[model samples]
Target: MGVVRAAGAQAAARLTARACRIAGRGATSLPGKVLLRLDPAAIGDLARRLPDGSIVISATNGKTTTAAMTAAILEADGRSAVHNRSGANMAGGIATTLLDARGDIGLLEVDEFWLDGVAAALKPRVTVLGNLFRDQLDRYGELEAIAQRWRVLAQSTVGQLVLNADDPAIAALGRGASSPIYFGVDDSRIGLDAAPHASDATHCGTCGTPFVYERRYLGHLGIYRCDVCATRRPAPSVVAQEVQLDGVSGSRFELVIDRTASIVELPLPGLYNVYNALGAAAAAHALGISMSTIVVGLEAVRPAFGRGESVAIAGRALKILLVKNPAGANEVLRTLSLEGGPLDLLAVLNDQIADGRDVSWIWDADFEGLAPTIGHATCAGTRAAEMALRLKYAGVAPSRITVCEDLPAALGAALDAGMGPLYAMPTYTAMLELRRELVRRGAAGDSFA
Candidate 1:
């Protein structure tokens, strides 16, 4: 009887989704919202019907890319997974994915705030926690609050746990889990000489003492030890050693898992992406996927939407790199700095509820590092003036900064002004707006949802 009701709700949701598409609206979260209202158990009932069970991936960042990498790996291994390809990752979005699934396994990237409830409902076979950083202080309170919730979820979940060993906060979560799998970077050549100003996890979560770092990778992710508590980063079983980063093009790294090594020529840039690949590889390893298959999957995985997505329009390349929080923005800026030339940028800053009403995080990002290289910057979105002001304070010349609150006008001006590749840095809502403009201009597909 329960299965019958769940099926009926799914059918109704599908009809609603079709109606939304016909009406020219995104059916990402609305249908699932309706389904859950009709049947609260729809998520679990539909998830359990999958033959190969489910895998849950969650973090403050990189969860979507990590899930996409895992999905690609599963595809390489000849397994089909029902995944949430779009960035919609809350309960309604996840339920919508389960409703539209045509595969044997469920692969999901959940929002950090929604991970507990979503994982509880899905009862995933493998749970991957990448890393935690300060994000959306208004919505998520503090990093410690989310960490506590994750610690509880880790303690209660009766499944395989895959964790990032370099993050002190994430590494500490493996305490009571049954043999958690740890993944991290072992390449000192790629490490930063000093920690960035936007580093989040500098203190040990266990002892409340400052962590002594041997090397700092992206933000607070690196090898560290606490002198007082004797707590240190776990020796990861799955590691990325001897990494080579190539500007904005891609990266190469030696992926070592359980004493076996394979060279992965990843088509993604930056050390943050290397961490994303490691998390995905570790999760796949936990699922018994072969090393060669994982490498193939990592090599073939494409960028998820605005995270390093590029489009060619009007004889110039427009690259979209999503920047929401400090850690994420810093990484994007760092990657742009690698291009080693003057850059043309379209920066959008929105204060939508999804983007957090507080727009103070831009102050923490390392925009100064790329200031000297910024040839021309057009600031757009709801807070265009503030973004332009930020660039000016970061050492960018006032003459080089253009303030245009409208996205379409700003995009046209930025493209016309640049002789080389143009970079677009936008927050969540702003990215959607920018993509919509791109789609209308026939540069991008309407299938972003």
Candidate 2:
């Protein structure tokens, strides 16, 4: 590390400590508006100081869960893996996390928008490219824009490029690489019968021709063939197939790595997570770990916060999913096909800064189909009335919807509405409020329980 950069990192560590003390919360990513008080070279220089090189994981969705899964795999194999588990995905977050770790295998979860900046600062040893979907249309112009950035940085990266074969946006990222390692689901039973409302990849990235789908796993992902010229889902080196999602029962699938195969069952539900497991397993294999350790680590790891996140409440488990954008929220709602009868729902909508200034994307979500199964719903947040109105339009009876401005009251009403399990879907900031409410209501004991 350069002298100036080393000094900057030390300064950042000290400053991070000061900020934590001032805020009374643990050190976290600086607010975007907060003055960035460090040398830009400090992050890159510190990465060199670590024994194990950096691993950068980027995606529109699944980045957090994939980061957790990869870190758990590394930790289970007895490697010290450092990560930003607090959902901090910017330059300061990466810098502060690296500063705190001093030296460890850094599994950095970075935002798609900040990939270039973070990559220029921290030249990662391995980069995992998960599928890209249309999300936060205002912040990110389009899925193609993020892919373009990845395309540029992939040339400069010194380590393995772990790409997703199912996502053509991610698949095209490996165009110039020397057979970059790929991982995806090869199962037929676990995908959509045809394209659903949320599928994005219709036109080929390489050519402008419309891509034909042989099968679709989730949204915009599946084995596809380009009709015009040459563009399709890349064949992954490590693939998962014969996948079976048993809803509440969990998912069991087979993994093929280095030509060896094994059956593994993840306690987490949904098909998207099957892809998450594949991404983590592929990264683990690239890290040179055995299949056994990968299997155990994956099986042992639990879900991430608000991404198919579950909590035990009132003697029943409540699944809390963060429905921030259209594609992600649609996928979560689509997973409802696995649910049986009517389900209790708690939806919180807010225009908080963290939760995007615009909440209009709720209309794009497939809430109409999901509304029928919703037995009772408590709508809360700054936009609680808006959400209640939305549910009403989606065929939900006005009497079935409860609008409570306060989170705790809304949560209580939602919980009391049904003896069946509850599903809390909220925007980003609203999820935090629900978590706080969960703690305050003694739903979870003290201390973020």
Worst 10 residues of 2 by lDDT: 31-40
Q: For model 2, what is the alpha-carbon lDDT of residue 443? A: 72
Q: Candidate 2's residue-wise lDDT over 1-449, tens digit each? A: 46766575576566666877698775666622122454556678668878888889988888999998998889889998778887788887887677757546888999988888888777888888887888777677777787788889878863788998888888888889876998888876766765766667678977788888888877788888897887777778898878877775468888889779999888777787888888889888887989999999888888787777778887767888888777778777877657965888889998887777777778877788788888888999999999999899988999888999888888877877789688888898888878777777677543222
Give the residue spans of candidate 2 off by over 4 A.
1-5, 31-36, 445-449
In TM-score terms, candidate 1 sits at 0.98
Question: Which lDDT tens digits does candidate 1 get at residues 1-449?
Answer: 37688778888999999999999898888899889989988888888889988999998989889998998999999999999888679999999989977898999999999999888889999999999999989888988899999989999853799999999899998997889999999986888877888788798887788999998898999999999989999899999999988888888999999989999998888888999999999989999999999999999999988889899898899999998899999988988999986999999999999898899999999899999999999999999999999999999999999999999999999999978899999999999999999999999987564
Count of backbone collisions in candidate 2: 0
Could you estimate the TM-score for every candidate? 0.98, 0.93
Candidate 2 clashing pairs? none
Most accurate candidate by lDDT? 1
